[model samples]
Target: MPLKPGANPYKILHLEKGCTDKEIQKAYRAQCLKWHPDKNLDNKEEAERRFIEAKEAFDFLYDKEKREEYDNREERIRMAQEHHSKRMAEADGKRKKLIEDLEKREKEFSNGGKRSADGSTPMTAAQQAKKKKTDQRNFKEEIEAIRRQLEKEVNEEVKQKATLMKTEREKHQKSQEKLTPRLLLKWKTSEGLDYSEDDIRKLFSTFGIISHISSAIEKKDRRKRILEFESGANAWGAELETGNAPMPEITCEWLQPPVETVKKASDEPVKSTNTGANNLEHMSLDDLEAQIMGGF
Candidate 1:
């Protein structure tokens, strides 16, 4: 039986699209064997219909021109379907994007552009609190580090200053130690009376033990005199007490010894008082015997 126009011959024969002519023939033979009227006497009518459909499919596919036309038509229909599906997919994608955009805007509007509309923060309250605590801890650590650095610097500066002061003090004390307990005195009396060295010495003698007193022999420096004390403390005391002077013109000042004199004094060697008998005590027995033999 002839197939109706637009009927899919490949479907009737259970053949795949783009099947070769040999494959179509093989499919038709197999259908005929399965649905022959003689092979199915009890279901002859249905078998005959199936058999006729298969025969019509074979006839249509056997004609190369008709088969090419059908294939072309099918290809055209398939292309149209694919084009429609592509358009539909594109439209769906656009629709989805528009919906997403609308939802985003709506969500933003609902939350005043800050968060989602569900009144939910991106992080939980506990998480936010923990982050805040971590940040605070880091800030404190930085501050503590800075404070420690500053304190260390300050302590180092103070220590350096103290060390410097100690060194300066030691140097001053050494310099002071080199000075003798002596004071230089000069007087311009208000009464225009000449004060002898003895008189000046007698007046300052009340402060401490006076070692000696001498008047300056220089004619131009006739008012100048030297007063030596037994001790530095006495010399300083006398200087302090006589700072105002008996008549405001008798000034006393500490006398600094010359550096060369002090160095010379320090470099002087001690004289040994060891006699021959005194040396004998320190002499080795061999050396004493050798000395006695050498003298003989």
Candidate 2:
């Protein structure tokens, strides 16, 4: 199935990236059952749409090659977005500083300080208002200019980055999988009450696409919430950015090594161990029966 633009197969299937084939199949089946038209008679249209979406996601991700390409593209896009955000933040800081300096200068002028280098008197209220208006307009213009320049730079860099990624992907087509970073985060408040998943998304959505959020009660009656971002970088970014935010004043920690890795490790085959009967391998049937009965 052809993948829809801007559609994320992992999110559609409710599975994280690097999930095993069996996990994908299980999620697909769950989605199929949940959204089956017969099961959602009252909302058949929406259900059918979701059902088709699930199928498309399954088909696209079931193919190793296609899924790898999709993942690589998503990574490139996320990196570009983070770069752009960082640049814009720097520009905003500079803009704020400029505004502060302007305000300080206006305050100095208002306090009867020399208005000009040539020992000029303080301006009247009318003149001050005019000056303030002009300064504000100039500040706005400067901010707009900075925004345009940053946008241009980001666009050019993103284009170059995409081209570079393509070339690198071709060169390393058969390379081993890279180490996946931790994208799942544990969130909880000091009060031990967790926010709803929708509320959590509203708070952290600006940082990145949230794949899932689950709430649970841990030991000692502590309520815990696990927030999963589609990008590990975004998860880390959210942790850093939310530190000073008044809302969502809760604590967050990246779940180390990611959940998918833990699942995969647990799924590995263990070495076979000898049974208790192996101790009596040398005994005859009658002797083994006698020994087993005695042991019992």
Could you say which candidate leads in TM-score? 2
lDDT of 2 by residue, 153-238 (tens): 97898789879767766544322222122222333455444456676778778865666665443444334455555533223345
lDDT of 2: 0.61
Displacement of residue 148 (Cα, Å) in model 1 is 75
Query: How displaced is residue 21 in candidate 2, in Å?
Result: 0.9
- For model 1, the stretches where C-alpha displacement exceeds 4 angstroms are 113-296
Question: Per-candidate TM vs. native?
Answer: 0.37, 0.44
Per-residue alpha-carbon lDDT of candidate 1 for residues 1-296, written as tens digits (9 for 90 to 100): 22444578989988887789789878888988899888999998798777766766776677665677667756855675576567556655655665565555444444433555476755555655565566556655655665576567557656765685566456535544443455556655455556776777678877667767764433332455666665333233454444334453566654422112121257853221111111132233344344433432
TM-score (C-alpha) between model 2 and the true structure: 0.44
Residue 258 error for model 1, in Å?
Answer: 99
